[model samples]
Every structure is written in structure tokens, then in C-alpha cells.
Target: MNQVNTVVLLHTVLHCHFTSADSIENYLFEHYSASMKPRRNQNELVEIDIAMTIQTVLKVDERFQYISFYGWFEVQWRDEFLMWNETEYQGIKKISVPYQQMWVPDISMYYSEEHIHDLGVHPFVSVTSQGHVTWFPGAKYTVQCYLKVKKFPFDRQKCSIVVAAWQTTDRMQKLVPRARSVNEVKGIAENGEWEFQNFTYEENYDAEFDLTKIVYTLEFQRRYRYFLLCTIMPIVILSVLNSLTFLIPVESGERITYCLTLFLTFTVFLTLFDQTMPRNSIDVPYITVFVSFHLFLCVISTMVSILTISSKRGQECDSRDTQIVPLESQGEDLHLGEVNADGKRSGSSGKNYLRRTLKSILKEVFICKIDTVMLVMNFFFLGSSAFVLVICYIS
Candidate 1:
């Protein structure tokens, strides 16, 4: 494998240079100092033109909020000391030089230390007779980024990578994008989780730090079809089941159990996805908030089920009463079972009044109102959840 790599590298060099004169390249660089910037004067500013193209975006870790990708950069700058007449060097136009023997700009990516592994490989530099230097190196880079997952599985994210000259002010090193057409990523390989979207850039000069940073902003759209099976479909199934709990008749004695089961399902799902969500305080995923609201509905549904069961038991006891019989559905009108022959009730009138009051209280408090209330609540909560999701996604 190593022999094949070496042969391929040699072929690439020969194919690009197309000249057999190695002596000309040596003589030009032999007396050159590759440690300092290629400036003719001490105070001259060296302008570095850079164009980067993302060949592939390998991974986007939303939980940890980082992106890993493979790409190459084209860096060009002019050196005053390396220029020579082509006629003096047998018309040699360009030559390859070892990258270590040339001075490269002190540029590094900002917010780049989250991962410690290095992905760059040393590459050769190309120099022309006019002292134009071009360095092309391909490598994989992982950088820190934050997640905006308010819409979650259906979300589009805007991430940025900042590149600037480290420990150098804008006066000594001026960076420029090669061209408007080439500044964006040339092309990208398909990723399973995220689809590549177009990118933009901003070059800002900070007067306080005397630094200029180029911020390349890239957007990624999540592949929501993948999440339909894993996330959205399950929530939908649970929501339907939760709403169906109210339709089960109270006499079947399964309404409370079913409602409680729905509640637990939502709980387990929320716990299962907790690690998948980014730990951000500002943007809470609408999916999370929606599930929480659904869980609250479950609690309400369970409480309604319990009230109906209790109301059924109390009504059965009230109907079997003989001492104080209720003639009205509300249990407000009641009288002694049989008045004595003397035409007066046997029990005290006050005792009869107290029984009427107690029965009326039970009838009014637990009257099995879930049918109407559940119908209205289901619409309210389900509609509100949809509204919340729409607002979050639109914003």
C-alpha cells in the first residue's frame, strides 16, 4: 500500500510540473529563507487568498453539537524574494517544493479544540517563476458548533466555522476570499442524516482586537423521513391511544388502566430521547414540549377516569337507599320512605334535610362529566400542540 501511494504521488508531481529540470527549483530555493513571510519590506502586508471546498460532510453530532468533514483548501500568496526570469532558468514555469521548506500563513480555525485529534497531512507546495505560491492540502476537520433544535427532526441548522490568522493583526496579514463564485463549497457527498444546503460567509474586522475573521456559515437540513419511523410515528400512535381512553365505557372498568398506560408510554419515550437532545437552555424542542403537554393530558384523563368510577359507585348506593328516597335525578328532592299513620315523618325534619344535602353534594361533585370535558380537552391540547410546533418551526 505504501509503495502504491509513493508511486501515485510521484506520478502526480510529474504530471503537474511537466519539466525534467530539478536543478532550477533547487537553485531558486537554496538561498531563500522559508521561516519568515515573503515580503520585500519589513512593514509590507502579505495578502493571503484562500478558497476552501468541502468534498464531503461525514457526520453531524447534534447531541454534542459538532461537525466532522473532509475538504481541501487552496491558499495563494506572492513572494517577492523567489521571483526570477524564466529565460535564466530554461523557461521553467513552476516547480514543487516541500511544504516544510516554505512559509505558510499562521492561520487556524477558531472553536477547533473540542476534539484533540489532528486530521491534517503535510503536502507539497507549488511555486511559479513569478513568485506565486499555491498550497493545496486535503484533510478532515471537526469543529465545535451549537444546535438549534426547536423543530428537531424537521429542523434546519445554521453552523459556522471561523478562520483567522492567529497571533497576527490585520495590518501584517490580510485574508481575502478567492472569488464570490468559489467561496462556497464546491460540492458535497451525501450524508445519511443531513442534506447539504448552500452556505454564506461574513468577513468582519474587529477594531478592539485588531483582528479580522472570516466566518463561513453552512446550513444543514435534517432528513426527517428517517425520523418518521423512529420518533414522529410513535408519538402519533401514543397520542391516538391517549385520546381513545375517554371513548371506553366506564362500566368496562378499563378506562383508568388504559389512560395510565398511555401516560407511562409518553414518560418512557421522553426518557429514551433525553440523551438525543442537545443540552441547550434557550431553544427547547417543540417535540419535547408537545410530548410533555400530552403527558399532562394523560394525567387529566386518568383523573377523569377515577372520578367516573367513583361517581358510578356512589350512584348505586344512592339508588338502593330506602330510609331517604331520592325522586329527582339531582337527589335534591327526597322524603321519608313512609310517613306514619299520624301523618308525620318518623325521623326529625333536620335529619332528613341533612341527608338531602349530603346526597346532593355527591351527585353534583362526581357527575361523570368526562364525555363532554374530554372531547373539548382533546381538541384543545391536540390543537395547541400543533400550534406550538408550527410556531416553533416557522420561527
Candidate 2:
């Protein structure tokens, strides 16, 4: 009966166009109702093939864990009134119809994190007078996704854009991939921290939920040059400077002040860096661990300086005691009775030998010279830092 009506309408419309273009327009408007459903048979599923052309990637927020991009979504489906026979209409196979007068799919983005209150920019759709509907709509969206930042400055992350029908079910509609598979997208603005590596597309059919989902995966690698200059390089320079404090003379009384100042600088950097990272991420960034290790090295260098200074002061006190005792022995009269009063001469000789031996052992086992200890510390600090950097960048 629907086919017979279509044939009858085609015959009438062919003759009506001779009157005026409005006659054909009026006939189409009367034939199709916007309130009418697009599906010829309401119970059968209407399959929609979707494709996207990404204009630009606006921004990716690590703190908020979201991605913003500008793109247009192309949805192709079939409609009934839009179709016409070219032989009957003097080769007019397709025609423009006011979208307000035709029914469009109620497809919406699923898993959208930010709410866009506007109805979005709708454009005119091209349709064959037999009912093939092709609609393209532009959109700017911020979608929430999980980010893996354990390696941070040298990490590769895979983020995805998941889209599905908000209310449409498998029984009512089906989603399909475009013929070209995944289309190319442009990253218009260069990201300071991340660079686009590659992308892939997937179609997921969920049996339990009876829904079809589309996923587009974007993989990005962190751009290390910026972070190397702003964060990692500074940390390394500070670590090397802390080791330099070992070169300061203990007698100058400046070593303690210098180490404390460097330590305070590390504290400031750590605090600032924390604000830029995701606070609730399960995996701690390798860069954070790297900076923390350098900070620990600074603390150790400071403590060592304090200990060395204290040891030098103790040695001076012992030397003064020895000098005063010799002067007293000379003034007391070099007699056996004086010797007995002063304790045994044998005991004094033993004490002098032990003190010399202790001094020799300390000089060998613990670095007595500031420059020597500092040279060793510098080598160790730089070596360890380089090793960690290699591992982070390569893997």
C-alpha cells in the first residue's frame, strides 16, 4: 500500500512542477512530516554509518583529565520523502529540503563529561528524492578520559573518544563504521607537553546492554624539550650546586648557610611542581621521583658538612690541652715527685701515641680535605642522574 502511494505521488508531482517550484516544494512538505519517524517499518532497525573529520585538537588538560577538540560528525542514514525518480523530474534526482520539515536521528554523544547546553550548529542535509539522508554537524567537545602519567615528561599515553547512542537501542538502531575506517585529524596548535603519535578506531558491540559503541583512540608522546628545560634541567643544576658546597672551607663558616639556602630552593620547586600534576593519580610520575632523589642528596651533603666541621673543632681542643700540659710540666720543676703528682710518664707517652694514630686513621677513612670530598660527591651525583635519565627516556 505504501509503495502504491509512492507511485501515485510520483505521478502527481511530475506534472505539478510545471506550475512553479513552489508547487513541488508544497507537495514535498505535505508528503513528509517532521513528526513522522524516519524508519519505513517502525519495528525494524535503522543502521547509521558515522564518520568524523577533526579540524583541530584545542587542548588536553592533564589536571582535569579531559580532551577538547573541534570536529564535524557525519551521519548517513535513509529517509523516505527525500527520494525522487530522476526520469520523472527532468533529471532532478536530489533536492534541498528544510531540515525543520524532515525527521533526523536523535543521536547524541555518550560519556560526555562537560555539559554543552546549546543544541549545537545544525546544517542543511543533502537527500536523494528516494530517501538517502546525509547530515554533517559541527561540534566542539571536552571529553573525559583516563590518563597514564607515570613516566610524565617521557611517557606515551593512549586516550580515547567514546561515542554511543544516549537513548537509542540495538532494537531501534545500529551504529556502523565508515568505509574509510579511521579518518585523519589535525592537531592545529602544537602542545607544549604532548605530541600526537597515532590513532585507531574500534566498534564495540555489547550483548548484555544491547548497544553499539564507537571508540577513537589517540596516542600521544610527551614533548620532553619543554620539561627538560623548565623542570629537569633546573633540578639537575641545583643538585650539582649542592655538591659544590663541599668545596667551601670549614673555617669560613659559610658551608652551613649555603647548604640551607640550596635546600630551601628545592622545597620551592617541589611545591610548584605538585600544583601542575594530577593529585589523585595512582601511578606517581617518574619525574617527581627523580626530583625527590636529588633533594635527598642535597640533605645528605648538608649533614656531612656539619659533621666535618664539628670534628675539626674537637681536634683543635685536644691540641690546646696537650700544649698547656707541656708548659705546666716545665714550670713544676722536672722532678720525680712532680712526675708522680702529674700521674705516670708512661701514661702520657701512651696517650700521645694513641692520639696520633687516631688522627692518621680519621684522615684516611673520612675525607679530611673539602676539595677531595666534593670531587667524589660531584661524580656520584652526576652519574646517578644520567643513569636515571637514560632509563626514563628509553623506556
Candidate 3:
């Protein structure tokens, strides 16, 4: 077995060198040789610039029947320079290198899983030299895994999504992330669908500077179905009931009773409607218009009932005779009262005859006219109201 000497310099730029014949060192040298080389300085400083380009692919896992994200990254060393240390050792150095922080990539997601599926490599910071290598403890890389849904149907304020980081060891459990946030994308989610907004990073240490395995979860709710059932059904039923008020006979006491009852019923329904809706009068909603029509019908029905009662009373009055007829005695009919004036009649027979004939004819005519008028008015008003109600309801 052979032993090797290794030296590492740690700063904003990490530089390291190894002197050994180890097979692992030879492999690292061959693979990364173009990037890692001997420096020309006296202190044996070997500057190396390491950078990573990440490629992400998302696919629906046919076997698992779930969405999966696959990410691949390649770390390359560029612009390598060789130098010598004071101890006569060869080293590599560079003035500028890609920042380590930029190497960490993160993805936004919405589900929970314990283990990351198809994780290609464990998160680590690595550099290799001949048979000797140094590891940076607690150094990690983070990649954000996210899905951009084109459009989400619903209020964005109420909608939410969750991202979970998981490890391969526990496939069923979700690994929690350090932080999460959300942003609204402009001109997106406008067509009743979800739009991919950028993921917001959180201040929680759990979310900072690291690559982890993760998935995302999405959630939302809609009220179209509920509105159709709860609002439309009741309004339709109530409107139908309102129209039925016309079926009651105008003379029947039930006519007034039904109208008043329906009026109250609709009033209560309107109260409920008001509570459910915001206070706005841009245009009356269909339900509100239906309620108003029914209310109008109830009011008209009540008025008609009152007018009918008044008209019937008027007919009764007109049917009574204004003058009374005198009855004649059977045996004493020939005896007439004495007349004082030369041309005046003393008998009651003539007066009685005149009263009976004239009063009877007048009563009959007056009663007939009153009855006809009442009948015509009732028919016209009720029929007109009925027609109006029908039109409103249908409309």
C-alpha cells in the first residue's frame, strides 16, 4: 500500500492538490485533468473553476401512474492553471471561478414523499486528486423541482400548492422543505386555468442553499354547481307558486289568505337572498327579478279582492227599492179617502200603483248594471295581471 500527501486551501474559491499513486487519484486526474492542473506560483496554489449546468426533464411515470421530474447535471472545470508550492509541489489555481451558491438549483413542487425518486447522485461538494481527496462537511446542493400549470380555475387567493422534498430511502414519506412562497403570474390564470407563477423562497433555514429530492401538490374549489342548485331551484319553485295564486276564486276567502301568505313567503325568501349576495344593484339577478314579479302579483291580487267586495256591496244597495208599495184591504177597497181640493185624489190606490211600478223597474236596472260592471272589471284586471305574471316568469 502507498501513502499520499494532500493539501487543501479553503476560501471563497476552494483549491486543493494531492501527491499520490492511488488508483482513485489516477481516475480523478484522467476525468478532470483538463480542468485541474499544476500552477506556476511558488506557494503551490492550484486554482480550479468548477461549474454545473443542470438539465431537467419531467415525465408522467407510466408504471407509478404519477408525475415525476428527472434532473441531470454535469460539473465541468474550465481555465485551469498550474503552479508550484514553496515545498516544491505542483498545484492548480485560478483567479475567477463560478460561485458555489449559483451551483445550487431548486425546484418548486406540491406533494410529499419521503424519498426522492430516481435521484442520480447524493448532494455533495467534491474535488479529487491522485489517491487523495478532501470532502467539505455539511456542504450541500439544492435543486428546485416545480410544475407550471397553465391555468388554474378559481380564485388565486384561495388556491394553494405545496412542495415536498423526499429521499429515496423512504418513498412513502415526504421530506419537508426549509421554505415556501407563492406569486401571481400576470396575464396567466385568466382563462379559467392555472398559470405557473414563480416559486417564492422562504427565510426558513430549511429552504436555503441546497439540492434535495421533492414533489409538488395542488388544491382548489369552485361554486358553480352549488349556485345552480341552491339559488336557481328555489327561485324557480317560488315563482311557480306565485303564479298559482290566480287559481283561487275571487269570492272565496282563501283568495286573500293565499295572496298574503305567498307575499310573506317571498319576503322571507328575499331576505335570505340578500344575505347570500353582496350588496350590488348593477342589474337585478334572475332570482331577484323573479321574486319582484311574484311580489307584484300578490299585491295586485289583494287589490282585486278589495275591489270585488266593494262592488258586491254596491250591487246589494242598488237592488233594494227606494219606495215601498202599500197593501190594499180586500173588503174596504171601495172606500177612498176624501179629497179636499177640486182635482186632488183622496185614495191611496193610485199612489201605491205608481210607486210599485216605477221603483221595481229602477231597482232591476240598477242591479243588472252593477253586476255586469263588477264582473267585467274582475275578469279584466285578473286576466291582465295573469298575463303579465306569465310574461315575467317566462322571461
Candidate 4:
């Protein structure tokens, strides 16, 4: 096995320029000297720049930001024999390599600690000159990261998964991600790693490279709890109320009133229900059926009441003579003049009393029959109303 040795290097550059008094410059120089002296060898910077490139493989959760994975390419500076020079400071002096291997720092573990609510992620590879001499001016680098589905969050039958790529530049702050249109440039899955099959890059120093972020979103249908509560509960209560109408007695004077009141109440309820539900000729809802039944009950009760009253009146007329007594028996007869002395004499004698008896019987029949018929009709009306309400409840 061939083994390659690599070195890690750290560098710091002063980004501030001082124009105001030399105080700032002097302070920076003293600070730099103090910090670098211990690590420096000889009278020069121990670090040198080399042409170094970086490629990273990072796995971050698109939904939750709790955990993540990161991997980076190993890089080190190599001695070049071809660049050796003859007579000037030439003792094959040990040169400092500028490229270093990247490692995860404890502070960079969770992004939430940085107060960064939004994140832009991309697979990036960058090349920079490591030596102070700036040997490689324009070498370019490329990197591509692919996502693999290990397990799905929901059942496949209920939902689907999608992956999309997006690139952000200064002009566009945020752009929606979309699936790659080119078939050849799509991601390739092998073993566990999904690789970008057709990714490519050309070396360039000044041009801005494309740094893109990719994201995936999942959506599904869910049942709403409020809809069930608002719609189903009231319907059940109305049905129960309709059923309770049967408990009323037939003899109660309020039977007709009760049935009619329920009918009207349900009509109002139906109006409310109609306002909520979409207008369609689809199968009638159970609540509507209940309302219709109550309306029918109202009609039936009314008819029966009318019929009962009519029948009672007829019976009363038939038994009127039996129900009433002769007015002559009270002894203050105003028709005394109308009855001649013969009639009175006959009335007193039991001989011609059959005619008087026949008249009395006719009068009693008329009055008694009217009274009987009215009583019967009232009862029949009440009884029929009760029967219909009971049937409505039972059915």
C-alpha cells in the first residue's frame, strides 16, 4: 500500500489599512510579530501558499436541523523538484506548505447557535494559492453533493418525495428549487452514495462560481377535527330531538302544537344546514330526511284532528234526543197558549200522551247527539295526533 503524508496549515491576514497616524499600523505589526514569532522559523514566515483545492460532502436534514454529516478531501503541500534553483539561498531549505486538511470544529456543530434561521447549502470545491509566492494563479475547482433517500417519513401510497436544485446570486435573494431538466445531469445512485453524474467545471480565477442550494418538501392530506365537530354533532342532536316527539301523549291538548312546533324548528335547522352544505342533488343527508318526516307528521296530525272533530259532531247529532230532556217538564211552559185545552187535557190523561212523548224524544235526540259527536271528535283528533307523533319517533 502506498501512503501519502499530508500537512495542515493555518494562516491569518490583516484586512485593515491604516491611513490615520502610524499608531494603528505599528500596533498591527507588533501584534502580528508577537503572535507569529513563536511559530516562525528563521527571519521569515514559516507558512507558504500552494495551489490547494477543497471538496466537501455534507449531509444535512432538510426538515430538522438537529443533526448533520460532513466529509472533506485531504490536502497537503508537495515539494516540487523541478522548481529548484541554483546559488541563491539554495540549500534545499525546508519550505512551509500552506494547504491544510479541513476538520469539524466544536463551535460549528449546530447552526442554530449562530442565530441563523435560514440556511443556504451547497456542495462547493474551491482552489486557492497557498504559497506566499502565489504559484498557481487561476486554478479552478468543482464539487457536487447528491441526496439519497434512506427512509420515507410517510407511507408511499399517501405521498411522494421530490428533490430539486437551486442557485442563488446577488440579484436573486431566494429562488425556488426545481428538478434538474437535463437527464444526463441527474444524480446517480450507487451503493449508498448518490453522485452527480454529469457535473463539470472549468478552471477560472476571477469569475464567480455557481454556489447552489437544494431542498425537498413533503405534503399530505389530513382530516380536520373542527369540521367533524361542527357538522356531525348538530345533526345527531336534531335527530334525537325528532325522536323525542313520540314521547308526548295523545290526550294532551298541546299535541298538535308540539308537532307543528318541531316541524317549524326543523325547517329553520334545515335552512341553516343548507347554508353550510353545498347545493347539490346528491343523496339526501340523514338530517334532511328527519326534517321531511316531521313535516309529514304535522300534515297527518292536522288531518286527523279535523276528521276526529267531524266524526264527534256527527255522533252528537245522532244522540241529541237522548242527551236532552223535555222543556215542558220544568213547568214554566211559554207555549201554554199554543197547546189548546184539548192538548193539555190529553197531556194530563195518559191516553193521548204518545204524541207528546214522541216530540220529547225527538228533541232529546237532537241535543244529545250533538254533544256526543263533539266529545268523540275532540278525543279522536287528540288520539290521532299522538299516534302520528309516536310513529314518527319510532320510525
Among the numbered candidates, top lDDT falls to 1
The lowest-lDDT stretch of 10 consecutive residues in candidate 4 is 101-110
| Model 3 per-residue lDDT at 383 | 59
* Candidate 4: tens digits of C-alpha lDDT, residues 288-385: 55445645645554555445445545555545533222224334432211234234321243323555567556655644464355345434544554
Highest TM-score model number: 1
User: Model-by-model lDDT, in order?
Assistant: 0.77, 0.71, 0.39, 0.33
Tens-place lDDT digits, model 1, residues 1-395: 99999999999877645553466666767887877779979589999898767888887887888888877778899988777778865677887788878777867778875323222555788888888998876677888989888888898988888878777888888888765554354477778888877777779887887878788888878999978798888897788677777778888888887887898899998986688888777877888888898999899888878977887877777555534533333256444343444445554444566766697676655465657678677877787787777787787
- Model 3, C-alpha of 166: deviation from truth (Å): 34
Write model 2 residue lDDT over 1-395, tens digit each, in one string: 99999999998877666543444466667767786667667787788888766667787777678888777778888876555566655666666655667777666665565533322466577777677888787778777867777877777887777767766688888888685544363434456656776766799988777898888788878888888798878887887787677778778999889988888998888787687677774967777776777678778878888888777777767555443233124453432221333454433444555566588578545656655766597668767876976787677
- For candidate 3, the 10 contiguous residues with the lowest summed lDDT are 149-158
lDDT value, residue 382 of candidate 2 = 65
TM agreement with the true structure for every prediction: 0.80, 0.76, 0.31, 0.25
RMSD of 4: 21.9
* Backbone clash count for every predicted candidate, in the order shown: 0, 6, 54, 26
lDDT tens digits by residue: candidate 3, 41-130: 323422221111112223322122233333232323211221213232234321221223112222223332422232234444333222
Q: Is candidate 2 or candidate 3 better by lDDT?
A: 2
Residue runs of model 1 more than 4 Å from their true location after superposition: 1-22, 114-119, 180-186, 228-230, 311-361, 364-367
For model 3 the local lDDT of residue 332 reads 50
Model 3, C-alpha of 46: deviation from truth (Å): 31
